[model samples]
Target: MKVDGEVTTGLGKAAYFLSQEFYTKEFEKNLGFIPYPGTLNVIVSDEYLDEINEIKCNCENLIKPDEGFGAVRYIEAKLNDVIVGAIVFPAKTTHDENYLEFIAECKLRDELDLKDGDIVSLEF
Candidate 1:
């Protein structure tokens, strides 16, 4: 499926490959398995287009996955410096399943104002 959004910083060939590899490894480490082999579609939002552009221009690099199954495709949208919203592409076969869980977790985190190093475990 084609996911359409605003144009953010265009990723280079090497960056794209590295990002894919990093996500693959992170998924295995976190879930004790690899994602279902499939081509995942990522859409970058226009809201963070300028920020992404600035980062690329200055650093010549994009933010990579942070040692997890979920990776930010593009900032999607932001409120101030905080990432209020984003589009994450997981290698899982069903994107909705992962997305729903993400939303639920975000809600809980927001409700409790959870901080870094706090672990939230879900039974699935």
Candidate 2:
């Protein structure tokens, strides 16, 4: 399955959660690399909300959070048809259904030379 979304700025909060040792360790173990200490925020088109939810539902690699933190679920995907990454959904996110969070071994924005309003596609 594939989903496309527009690049958008995030709330500047993902780094806090991603940088935690708990999450970084799990990411390294489950994802085979320690993700960069942040996420690439993308806003999906409304028409694809169902597909996004389906992807969320199919996630099996769940990361249970530490005390006072929310769990995250993710599925492996390819970004821009090349880079391996994971699309993540955090239970405590401020985003609605239209948003998808991507985590990769490196900063995706820099890796892809992306900026706000750029369109990116993810394939699973």
Candidate 3:
């Protein structure tokens, strides 16, 4: 599946969660790299919202979190056909259907030079 969206600022919470050893270990084990201690947030284009939601419903690969945290499901993805990563969605996420949260081995914003409103595509 391919999803396109504009980069956006997140709530600044992923750094804390991604920094947790339990989650980082799982990310390294399941996604193949220790994720940078943050996520790159995207708001799916209106044209792809429904498609992303459908994909979300069918997704199965998950990283179970410790007590008090929500399970996260991910799909392997390539950002802009360059950097490899995963699109993650927490079971208890506050985001709606339009949001896509990505994690990778490096901080995506710095690695990709991304900023709010920049358009990017993810292929999974």
Number of the top-ranking candidate, with lDDT as the measure: 2
Candidate 1 TM-score, C-alpha based:
0.22
Clashes of each: 0, 0, 0
lDDT of 2 by residue, 1-124 (tens): 8888899999999999999998999989988999998999989889988877877888788999889999999888898999998989998988878988999999988888999999999887
Model 3 TM-score on a 0 to 1 scale: 0.93
lDDT of 3 by residue, 37-79 (tens): 8889988768887777778789988878889988888888999
Error of 3 at 56 (Å): 1.4
Model 3, C-alpha of 33: deviation from truth (Å): 0.1
14 Cα displacement, candidate 2 (Å): 0.4
Distance (Å) between predicted and true CA of 19, model 1? 9.0
Better of 2 and 3 by TM-score: 2
TM-score preference between candidates 1 and 2, better one = 2
Show pairs that collide, candidate 3.
none
> What C-alpha lDDT, on a 0 to 100 scale, does residue 25 get in candidate 2?
96
For each candidate in the order shown, give its overall lDDT on alpha carbons.
0.33, 0.90, 0.87
**lDDT at position 40, candidate 1:** 21
lDDT of 3 at 32: 84
How far residue 2's Cα lies from its native spot in candidate 2, in Å, is: 0.8
- TM-scores of the models, in the order given: 0.22, 0.95, 0.93
Report residue 88 deviation for candidate 3 (angstroms): 0.2
